[model samples]
Target chain A: MSTYSVSDTTAPAAPRAALTFSNLSGRYGVGLAASLVWLAFGLSCLYWPDLGDWSRTGSLGIGAIVIAAFILFGTFSADYLGSAGQALRKRAPWLLAFGAFVTLWEVATAKFAWLPLPFFPPPQSILEVYTDDLPKLLDSVFASIKLQLGGYIIGATVGFITGVSIGWSQKIGYWVHPVLRFIGPLPATAWLPIAFFTFPSSWSASTFLIALATGFPVTVLTWSGVASVSSAYYDVARTLGAKPSFLVLKVAIPAALPHVFVGLFMGLGSSFAVLVVAEMIGVKAGLGWYLQWAQGWAAYANMYAALIVMSLLCSGAITLLFRTRDRLLVWQKGVVKW
Target chain B: MVVQSAAEAIIYPAVGAELDIDGVSHAFDIDGATLPVLDNVNLSIAPGEFVALLGPSGCGKSTLLRLVAGLEKPRTGSLREDEVRITGPHPSRVVVFQDPTLFPWRSVWDNVALGLEAQGILKTQRHRVDAVIELVGLSSFRNAYPHQLSGGMAQRVALARALVNDPKILVLDEPLGKLDSLTRIAMQAELVALWQRKGFTTLLVTHDVEEALVLANRVIVLSDRPARIKADIAVARPYPRHRGDPYLADLRKQILGLLGLEATW
Candidate 1:
């Protein structure tokens, strides 16, 4: 409701300054320098011969050149690109650091034969796995995502219901609290041998392990969240003609959302660990299974490629969860900063 | 002074239910010990009357208000509204507590709509929520969250939330106790104006003697813990009562004396 008026006079001057060459030099000089470094490395990959006979050298050079072109375009036309260009310009230092790291990695492994060949494959060798084995890697990625999502949704729903029941009813708490305390602390991986024997398939057993990993934190946090709601909140609702169902659904749940999100975050992290361990030990096909297969064949480049994919997958899942939390808890905008 | 129009009269009804508290007593169990709060209290409030209860600090004033609001049943005796025994909380009687206690996740409009939403009539009576928000002078802040509001503004939203239910009995348990003196004075006048316009049976509990005199037609003073009514005095003053009036100042002195404090000023 509070209106803040910006001076219109200063607005025109900002875009005019952005158009000036001097301003562009100051703002984007570092990014341009970083892009040029990448371009040089890309050019060297095409010209220089390697001691290790790395395939996909041309593909790596092309990828680097494309990235360099993006950065160059982003830096020069930052005003035109709007917020995205500004973001890329800001990441100039990180881009330069990454370029330096890749160059060193390439020099150590393929060029000089240092740091052991099988363990530390050059950047181009990892790129070769992507080009040659794209279909299998994509299948593994899909398997991992499906397995993780199925377990997470099941675990989160059951945990939320159990938590609310425990917090609300004395009889349910009495019955379940002891069991939860006894079984919740043990690692889900500890049950792998039994889970594999009991379940119909390796996939089902892995899912059970993932669910166990995700359920414990969610149950505990949600129980605490529900139990700790202010009595005053209930009083207000009751006096306003709210029934028991209304109190639980409308009053208790919305109030405890911040804590539930915290639980979900913890559960997601633990689920990732369990998912990988389950896949490696029991499941037929997933990123973890792919990693194990790569290691068995001594395809270290494939292993490195899978690791990169795994990190991206995990971070992407976390980002999706955070977006949901942000939308649901919009009223808590100023109270917490992510 | 707010003059109620004929159409507004039909909408608001200007008819409050009579309240009867018959030998009501209340106590809380603290650490396995009985803490008696209200002692043998009996009072009858007429419809459309504004009554203020003044008492010593922690003298079961809020406890009595809670009982009236039906948030808690008395240990003994009965409270009735229009001859119906009060057993539990209902929308017909609503209380505004010392703290606003607005749901932080709800916007001002959503918070005000809570009563209707709970009763499952919000879909049909949506205009009532808007009307109450306008009544509290918070229409401009309808979409704003609780955190965006100032202390006084949040309290107004609380009032609007309670008003949306169209309660016959409005319980006020030191609702302005937390406001600064200037806001408190301004709100006291607003409270009086609202009572005049709505004509609900108002039971206000306050620690401020002048606030009681300024807002209520009748003032009931209570004793310390295990509170007993000491005096019930009528304030025969017109609307826009001045704080500097000699009669009000004399009454403030008498009430302070009854509370075991000297009105030195």
Candidate 2:
């Protein structure tokens, strides 16, 4: 707390100048250098004759603008953004590397045509596909979202309740657990023929397929979570005057939530896989159906575009799940590194 | 049904129940082998008295505390409170274990309010949660989760949780043994202070002789396996008793002698 005067300590060394861009050398300035290279590549793409059927000037111009924006925003507002800005600045080099990759990809496929045909379509072809089929793509996206949500909700809920009941009572567990174990390892897709025959419509059949895929992991993990709850917790709750219901609902369920989240993540992954296959079976309008239609026509560009969308959608669902886990398990804060 | 408020039901400044252990004996079947834990452990604790059950580690001190807490019924005898036999665990008596065992999902305040909520009185007695949190010096961390607390802080939350229920008897099973030395000393003082203020009948099971001497009015020393009361020495000293007092020094020596250990001090 106390500050002491430095009594003219030792001989005063030569005064150093301020830390300016002149002093910032080597890797410290790599981000700026990379951005310049990206800009130069973008400029060349505009003037050079294209070997591809489509002109890539617009998309290349957009990419250059984005890189410029990042450079300007990162340099000027790095102070205002505080820690987030610092993080962005640290990751700037990765963006530069990505830009280099994009430049190489553009040259090889679009301008030079060095890669094989159809298999390696240029970035512009993918962009062209997005521009041409935006409306149909939107429709498929919504359809996929609806199917995934309905199936996931039904599966996760039923799985959670079943898991909790099985975990809570030995009598119920004795009958159900072994049955679940036998059925669990069998692939959900193995039920595809039965599901098609049993359901009245293709919609219901597809939904069942997704649900079956999602439910297994959730049920197994939730069962393990509930079963593994410490007896100490029950004892404490009992001594505190908790009833059977309170012990199960409040104590057991909450204590087992972390495990339940793990199950949800696994379920989400399998559900997506099942969703695609189910759509390919009988579904009319979804990313999976679109992929099938695109492949049948040999519109590889559209297939690539749909694959990107599917990947984004699936990752978005997973990100949402992670956020929910983070929110609910506030007590596990700082214990798990992201 | 007409319900009486907590204030009207519990008599403050002297709320503890008289505990009567009628020749209680208990054992556990460890892999089909009957392991004797306690042997005819007859003891009677007066109302509002502080009694410490002292024995070596693995001597069934915790088992005795559990029995008194009504978590486990004794094999051979009945344990009573205020002339009524204890059938099962009741909120009237609460146990604070050495591990704190605070629920990881709940915040400090919610953990303390658990008993009140269980008894269906939380809606009416919500204010006691803050009061108890403050009592345990966890007011600043009322909303903080259990994982966020230090060992000492977590133990305080456990203490607050037990106290919030206005329990008639407080059974502590070496609650402060896991803490660091400095925290242990501070918590011993805090425990005595709380007992004096709340006037709950305290049955503390501990292995530390100095802790028993410092906290309890009557220290009941027990022998090794199949724990039976070897000596029940009553300390006539008042609250805030001196650690270096000659009387406490002599008592510690005698307790050590009974435990088959030399008085190294």
Candidate 3:
């Protein structure tokens, strides 16, 4: 029996002692450096005289204290932190750099008024926007989320179906492929003028734009994905007594999924871009609307805050899609990693 | 040792299908030029007989096997299974290609169960999936995806996938051609053992004369391009036959002579 050995996945033997003096210094050195930098910068913010009125000095001190406390906990239970702790320990330099950047951003913008007033509000003023407009921000977040989800789901579903149809059937491809080629290249926002007139409501018009944006990439990729599937699989399935539907649904679809995911990624990127533009279509409450509203009043801090929120929201959606792709495409593990 | 549960899962033993090919001719359109491959090839394979089709490279032996598998229709004549003409691919006759062709997304068990699932018999014959996996000595890799498997293991999965269907006729288009010499030898023995156990009619297309002599009950040698039946040599030896037998050696010499190769060994 010429069997290959299966890899053993048991955790490496734990350190003999719970706490070791040698590794304590080795692991905690960078963490200690980060803590010291944050603590020093935080104290300076409290005591040092500011050129201008930067009101969030107190919060800076508190943020520093929180990070310091986490480092202290990490030092005591390195084993308990496990992989996350190990990552934090390894990324101590980058973390320290980030803290330094925040401290500099505060000093240069808010305290010193270096870059000029309305254009460059301090990080503290941005934080203050969160505190001052908590309710409005929450409403905007909810509304934005509702809009994003509605548009994304509709777009992705329609795109996937259209792609599979066009990819699988030559007849469908012959008719729909030319349309996809012509219209797919056009940006989703380009239809804004016509959409405003065509759709019954701005919401449907906006939704339609997002779907159009998402559907193109998905359709194109899916077509290629389906077209590129090795004919060997169909031959195998056919000889196995598989019906035509089974060949498409089971073999063709699963085989083409990796490519479909690539299209989904493209679609997601375009969806976000289109979502922000679509929200500018007289929507009552969304981050995009709020951004425009705040900018009109010259509350640049509020605009900055909205922009930050949008970044996080889009990133969160992308991360969620990645997780789904990972789960579904488990067979492709290790072959591709992001 | 067979798992009793797995053995119980398989309800039917493979009943070999008799194949009759009468005046079968095939061709291909290569760059808009008609390239004749097979010309009036005829053969009748008895039920449970293991026949090996031997030929030179580009001899169109694989095309012959593909015609039998019903993957392609012969241009001239008919291929019949017990007097019933084979128009298209049927579960009763399966071809194992040179490539393993296991679905990259599917696990070994899933690949083996594909045939049954395709026929909507997976619910009743699910256990046979495990049995076939075990038979291929891949029980531990049942959940492992195709990409994780070695070439030999992948080929075994392909074999198991075809065998689990209990195909009456099994076509091998140089299925073991890509394997390393050592694995190929081991697989040849395993193939013979499998054939003896299941008693399915086998048509193997190969360029390896020694391999043809080792496993086949009858060897059909084919001529190159516009492939004609050159020779049909029957081996009178029984199962577990010796490779170094004087008669086999003489037949090997004669086969080489017909192939226009002098016996240098």
Candidate 4:
């Protein structure tokens, strides 16, 4: 049995040794192919005459060529280029797919006019929005960040405190649980009409809606986290002469943190939906407002640009939250994989 | 063997406290039905004595240990340590539970430092934490988290955590119950050495009759649930006693018989 088991383990090693050289080349070959695809895309953008007027076609072509050059360089020197080159090499297949997709989009929209004119502007037209409408886009980005941060901070703090209170004390739970049950399930957008009427400004109303959206999940999850802490933990702390405050702050809070992060992730997702909806409905500025304005003016290129920016911002925020969760819950690393 | 040198590095003053369980009875409410656990149990433990409670599983020996630890209140009677009533858990009396119950988030050092930290004396008395961890021979694993430890190592950390408090009485609820036999034997020797060195009134609950005979100076056998004290037999053996000694084997048989099991071996 031992001999058989030893052979079973060594079986995979034989193939691994034989395939090492080819595997390395195969991995880098994907990056090489991806760069060639991007090179073809850039050349097509430069040579293909557009059926419609596209201003930043040259800039788009240059950008694609620059990307192709980077990928080609990275594929050849991945070993020396450290982590960045490794990341580029890893993403080579996706980049190749993206290059193909953009080439098709440009051909259909600009060169051939197969899709439509006003609706599906070429990729260069979206790039034109970035180049031409820089100031307004920058303003919208800042406005959205400020509003979202303010709402998120307020919502997270209040939710955490309320959750701890409800979880700790029966009296608080008795009073708040019913209210939470009543209000928590309703979408924050449903409060749009009343919030606008109640608050002084559309900005404040929008902030309130975002806060409401973020708070419910945070409260519920945090409460559950605190409530579900093993009674044995409390006993251990108490026997060690830990006071009520110490038990809550040190024991309960740290134990409940993983759940709190889950809540934060959920809250952040819901807040994005609320933020965009609120911006579209009433707010004067934000990516959502930019998108609405672009649509109204029949500037589909600008709308696409705003959408790209919105997705990047939302995904970036989630990544940052995950990073923080990873750091705080390092002890829980292998126990629960994100 | 590592514990011998570590034990010499620290010496505890004989601060063992007398425990008095005056007609203590306890019960639990399960599905609105009152279930009796311990029935009018009374025992007096002298200062610095190692006593082990031997019983069948679910015989309320653990419940009695909890009462001594001041983790739970008795339904009908009072428990006292050195003539003072044990109303709630305090640093003077600490417990090592069956599962080792070390906070999963804290490292071994931090877990051991808990009692002092809870008492707000960790900053000044950090050496106590280091000493206890060393005593348990887990100094190398001071920075290691609970999950990273094997069952024995984690149990050692739990012991260190309790010992850091310098408790007047140590309540162990089947502390070595889950360990494998080899590790259990080694830890049993280690526990005896620790108990002798520290001189803390130790109350250990276990179903292992031979274990009770080998470790405790006195073995108290209890009957099944609403556990009544059946017999309290004193093992007048000297330290570094042999496990293969016929005296211990005979006592083990007697205790097992008391627990309603024939010593077939």
Candidate 5:
């Protein structure tokens, strides 16, 4: 009756909104600027008389690749400053940059053999290698995705479910908690030999490794989540005569979801990181395996391309998972609706 | 009107004979020494009686309220509601605490509806939520969160939540003790209006002598720790009783004198 009025939510717009071209302008412009400076530096370095051990051409090619990586990262990070807009920063500029730079790279390497390798292919030849052997690359990519899917599913699901169960009640916690505390701290790769020996199959080994990697965090997050509900809330629920199952389903799970999802995102990322490394060990089909194979014979540019593709896939998966979290917790964005 | 209210009070002298606390006593160990809380307390509150237990802090006033709400049990004597021994918390008896205690995660409407939802009357219970929201003057802020509300509004939300459950008895554990004077006075006025309309039995615990005198038909005063009922005086004042009224002033002086804090007042 004597109630004061309450105000509505006032969620501030994030500084960098989705798909804004502001980051590209920053990342690429800064990158281009750095590349120009580096180019000048390399040209200046080329005139040194004592630079006979390493040829100027090879040094320039390697320096260009390293500078590109540095400048790309630099420009990209700066793009987020005025990042509030939602329009797709136009991709044409990025595409043109990628194309023109790569073409120059290919011509320099192929025509002049700027950076030569005995048993390995240069990037120009490697670009043609794709045209000549698209089937091989596709096969490897497909095999990797397939392995990743199975391993990711097994690892994430069991980890999440078991984590929640262990977190929710003391009984399971007593049984599983201490064991996980010790075992969970060990790196996932440590389990590879054991898994490979037990399973006798490369896929199972990778899946086991991946599950081991991601499961520990989920269990810990879920444990913390379930423990975090205010005892006052439990009293309220109990006073209301809620069943144990109802309490868990309604009060416990909903309260724990934000934490649970955080664990899930971490697990998803770990799975990607472990994917390539796992493949190179036992399996023959993932991006990791392809990178290793390309690197084996000193195919530096080919190795770099494979690395780039792997990075794209990894980033894409992570982005998708985060978007899923956004969809689930859109309310957390401070946009509450009546 | 005084004669009529007096007659009505006589007819239902005790809380219509529903709730009974029999010879209850409690204690807490402070500094490795046992300190008495409530001793030989015997009272019965029937349906629809708004009683205020007024006392100083450590007088076991809130402890007694908690006993009645079934949040705590007395060691010496049994407590009963409608002749049935009270044990754990029951939704039929809801409590409004001094602090707002509104769930931060829940919206205003959601917080109000939580008790009812817990009662399992969720779907097709439109009237319950709407009526309670209207009762508290928070229909406009039904979707607002506790963090977004002023302290006064949040307290009202807490009251609405208890009321929505249609509890047989409402317990106020120093519900308005934390409020500033202006807001507290306004809230007291509003409380009387709502109580008259709803007719739910209430037990308000407070240290404010004026508040106890204002809201309650009978204000039960208790002595300091190892509390005993010092006095039980029936009030004849009507709603919106003026602070400047000579009668209220005399009563205030009388209470302060009784509390042995006459020099301070």
Candidate 6:
């Protein structure tokens, strides 16, 4: 590795970088510009109804604008990488188009007051409603997320350790799998009545529901991950002089990571949904409780705000999870793969 | 017990001498019936010898390797290292499987270090990983993930993993079978180079007769299912032998002949 040869190697990197960035910019720029135009068009339709309405004769311009914004967002995000070799990337454009169509319908009902009633609230009103409860919305958001995260960690920790132990041992898998399968599919809600009678505290009842619901998914997923580890891995481990404990921890567990994470993500989602119901059932202060309270007071605006907070928190969690998966699995991304 | 006794009956052929395997046989319960997988197979590999077990699919060639590695116990006969019966996998015996079973989560160094780590080698001895990776010509990929490596690289990583423990014997089960033709050939040559450098007694099981002929000092051809050693052809070719060598082709046909496209029952 002489300096001259090193320089020779380094020189080629510039061209590679140039080519990659040029492709990236060329792809994303078009989508960005298209999105800007959508925003403009949407704004005009709202302000001056005569000019920008594409989907319906009379629709609020704001609804159209939101639709366009989301369309552009999806299109750009989906296309940035280029050539995923899968159908999802190909179908993304259509998905964005459909979203746009839905937005147009929403606008038409509210803006022009077409088919007026409780059927379709104006998109503008929904936005205002969301904004009105921003303070309380933040409160409920924190409250629900706090409970959800607590339950998820406890349930996932117990479930994963148990599941892996069970899966790695045939005798254990045989003993536990049948019992778990019978109990797992029983809905989280079904136990709510029993929990109400047994647990003295409403918070305990809510936490228990969250844990039970989330644990089933996490346990099932962990078992699947552990079971699906390749036979060759075991052979390699065996030949390498690994002890049984070494084999389980080193080979089986790491190989089962992606599957275990899938369970964690699913469990998180279910527990969140369950928490909302539990919060509304008896106790107060959580997002579900506040949502019910707002609805009872007929504060539609505040209710919408709480809903927005819920969406943001859930999507935020999903983004964090996907980012973690992507980072850990960098080798399986575009250039290098499974 | 039969297998162990059979191996015990034979000398390891002498110190630093060939491993003598005699009358090894095995069967598995397939659908509640005892299905014979190998029967009365005997072969010997001189110390530092490269012997490829050539056979068709389901011929129990892999089963034979697993038995040697102590991952499987044969029903009759035995496997031994230095005249001692091999009862379980130990750091002294390492195996490379067909799929290049490098742990996806570990880097190349960690994978290579796995064998030593299992033997309770101190963390200070971890530096030995670099030497093995270099022997495999995988120095550049030492930090790479299994998922990031090409098929050939993965197999090389697997070999490095096996060799880093400084095993007395190396067993490879179709280790290069997953690579494409060109990579397979390239890997075959690399394998021979590594064997010569490390000087570990090697036993490779493969479907490719030509690969066996090119690399092995002794090429053992097995009969179809319930496999037996049908032919034990001695390849007198030198190390780094070219595929174009004429004598190598002669040995290839002899191995193919033992496979018997027989009209004979």
Estimated TM-score per prediction? Answer: 0.95, 0.91, 0.94, 0.94, 0.73, 0.76
Candidate 4 structure quality by residue, lDDT tens digits, A1-338? 01111233332211222325675568567888889889888888999887878888998999999999998888877766767866887888999899999988888888888997889889999999999999999999999999999899888888998888898889999999999999999999999999998999999998888888889999998999999999999989998899999999989898998889889999999999999998998999999999999989989999999999999999999988988887777677463444
lDDT of 2 by residue, A8-28 (tens): 555543244344676345433
Ranking by lDDT: 4, 1, 3, 2, 6, 5
| Over 4 Å off, model 5 | A1-168, A330-338, B1-17, B27-38, B58-60, B177-182, B223-228, B257-260
Candidate 6 local accuracy as lDDT?
A: 0.73
lDDT, candidate 1, A1-338, per-residue tens: 32122355533323534546775567677888888878876876776788777778888888889988988887787767766976886789899888878877777777777789888898998888888899999999999999999999989888888888898778999999999999999999999999999999998888888888888889988888899999988989999999999999999889988888888999999999999989898888999999999999999999999999999999999888988898888788553444
Clashing pairs in 1: none
Write candidate 1's Cα lDDT for B18-125 as tens digits: 999999999999999999999999999999889999998899999998888888999999999999999999998999988999998889999999999999999999
Q: Could you tell me the TM-score of chain A in candidate 4? A: 0.91
- Write candidate 2's Cα lDDT for B1-265 as tens digits: 0111232333355678999998989999999999999999889999999999999899999998888788898999989998899999999899999899999988888899999998899998888887777777777688888777899999999998998888899999989989999999998988988788778999998888999999999999998879999999999998798899999999999989998887465
User: What does the lDDT read for residue A283 in candidate 3?
Assistant: 65
Worst 10 residues of 2 chain A by lDDT: A1-10
Model 4 Cα lDDT, one tens digit per residue, B1-265: 5464644656577679999999999999999999999999999999999999988899888889888888899999999999999999998899999999989888888899998999999999888888887788877788877877999999999998998888899999999999999999999999998888789999999988778888999999899998999999999999888889999988988877887787465
Please say which candidate is ahead in lDDT: 1 or 2: 1
lDDT of 6 at B236: 91
Chain B TM, every candidate: 0.95, 0.94, 0.95, 0.96, 0.88, 0.89
Top DockQ hit: 1
Between prediction 3 and prediction 5, the one with superior DockQ is 3
Candidate 4 residues lying further than 4 Å off, grouped into runs, are A1-27, A335-338, B2-11, B263-265
**How good is the docking of model 3, by CAPRI class?**
medium
Q: lDDT (0-100) at residue A61 of candidate 3?
A: 68
- lDDT for each of the candidates? 0.88, 0.84, 0.85, 0.88, 0.71, 0.73
Alpha-carbon lDDT of model 1: 0.88
State the DockQ, from 0 to 1, for candidate 5: 0.25
